[model samples]
Target: MLSRTIIRSPGRTFSTSTAMLNRCIIYTQNGDPAQVIRAITYPKLPSPPPNTVNLKFLLSPINPADVNTIEGVYPSKPSPTSNIAASGLGSQDKPVFVGGNEGLAQVVEVGEGVKGLKKDDWVVMDRPQLGTWSTSRNVPFHGVIKLPATGLTEAHGATMTVNPTTAYNMLDGFVKLQEGDWVIQNGANSAVGQLVIQIAKNRGLSTINFVRSRDDMGPLVDHLKSLGATKILTYDDLNDKSLRGKIKEWTGGKDIRLALNCVGGEPTTAISKLLGQDAHLVSYGAMSKKPLSLPTSLHIFKNLTSHGFWQTNWSKTHSRTQKEELIAKLADMMKENKIRAPEHTIVNISAQESDEEATAKIRDVFAKLAEGKFGKKVLLKLEDTAT
Candidate 1:
């Protein structure tokens, strides 16, 4: 139960007598994020229920998927809750849904029957859409995984559960790649793509990275190359008929057996054509907003196979022990500096700021994201500055 003293106002009732406040971004209905999303400060959460723990968020990433979810375009959906009503957070006609899919949090309070978790332990969400964009909340123990005791920064922990895990799985789950083998992919500048380049390099595999032409192509190419990309090409480069021949020369005529596709449509098909017989083509995203249309000959004559991967589905089917094991392996790589955190900017939300000011700051960030203005990742630091 929450330790609060109820107070009645002219038209509504709210809680008081608490020094600490819990604030989160929320929306009553799905729509344009700029218009629908707002921040609300509610009473601090009460003590947790059985097998649950109160988590104080350290940092959370504002991923594109989070924006899509709030717009009701993403497949994953967060549940609506009235838990914050007593403090008068949202409309009484409808429960509000909190926004965020990924975050790193520390356990501040643990409930009965909990094992292997206590106050001050760092953890990440085990599943998706649990409303991670908050100062703190109570989550079931099973909903979070205690991060490994590795020398990982808050940035690494905050972003690890999604992009890195996706890259790691897409490489290992789809095809059996060996040393000296080659991989091809588009969207190579994305967070997941950068990780793929480094992770593949760590396993002695080579990658052919492709990205859209940009004004600052030189620096971008240098960055990807630094991450172990064998070759970086713009989509426009694919128009060259000799490009395939040149790729053959680069890999010493070796069969390009694996292809990772995030951008669908032409680019995806173009990469698929480069794969050898019996190779696997994995599709994890379609950034182009177009359908993938491949020549039937590639599937029939070349014996190529196609598959799709979603980390959420994988987590839903796998055991907690299995998930922890994979995370540990990734952390080991992080310890060795084989895979590093992606380029990102931290957007801090201070407790001292008024609710309107905080809301404007977040919406501004989202507006920039919607306009493709933020070239790097955005991480949220919802700090309790007043404390």
Candidate 2:
């Protein structure tokens, strides 16, 4: 049985059994997250098997895809596990599916034959749908890639797997762009979009960014520009027939060979229209939830090509060596401060809180995200509340 007693001291209060207990947010069925998901305290993980290391997740992010996954909407799904055997009041008999797909973890215990990793080493998941929302678990050595020893924060490590990786891959995968080349992308204010802007700039590529009109558009525009966007425009500006001519002038009549799309609908069509001959447009997301519509002329006459990109698939297809190299390169960029971490807020889940309390807190965060209340990206600090 796990102890839930809270011990207090002059300047500290913590669960007496903190080190002995492991906690995870889980669901047996896919549905509304708040309704289906709940927290469970399990036994601290046993020593890992050969080639595996016990991990203590430090921080996890609450991305939109995570929420959709809880609701059974996302295509990728996490398998239910009996490994997390909760005790006492919140114990479960059936297998439970853990919630979360990205996180930063520290190796607490390493099994026999594990090489090059030691205690307290920071690492990030290399694959998707690994159920990252936990205090601890044992993972195979190949399932994680060790992060650089310094120059990264909990938020950066937790988030480096998804949006940033997406942005990095999108820019490099679909198009072979040269320095001074121009790229265009919609959803310029998105996390991935901001990264694309910065990374493209770092590569000496210029980006024409488009975003939705908002009441506080000025500050948002400034933020994107500060991240190295060459030009920022709203979706409304796409209605102008003269925008293409202006883009051409801005690019000095050079071909805009690459375009990134996250927002579908007509915004996608509008950006596709700006690409020069033999250009590639890559779509990773569709925030508008609308189909991508394009004229046949662009494909037939201009030899324009369209491709879809998903970072999860990319990670799975790539080798561990490739993943390590990519992560190391990005870590250096973080160290140099070339690519700044996104604006974010941390949601702390303390060991002191009961399963119900922790679940409610997480559900509230999701509710806020659904209603567009959280102004910044949310990172989950799911370890001991006191620490």
Q: What does candidate 2's lDDT look like per residue over 43-122, in tens digits? A: 76788999999888888888899989999989888877767656533235576788889999988789999998987788
Query: How much does candidate 1 score in TM-score?
Result: 0.92
* Clash tally for model 1: 0
lDDT of 1 by residue, 174-236 (tens): 788899999999999988899999999999999999999978899998899999999999999
lDDT of each: 0.86, 0.85
Number of backbone collisions per candidate? 0, 0
TM-score of each: 0.92, 0.92
Clashing pairs in 1: none
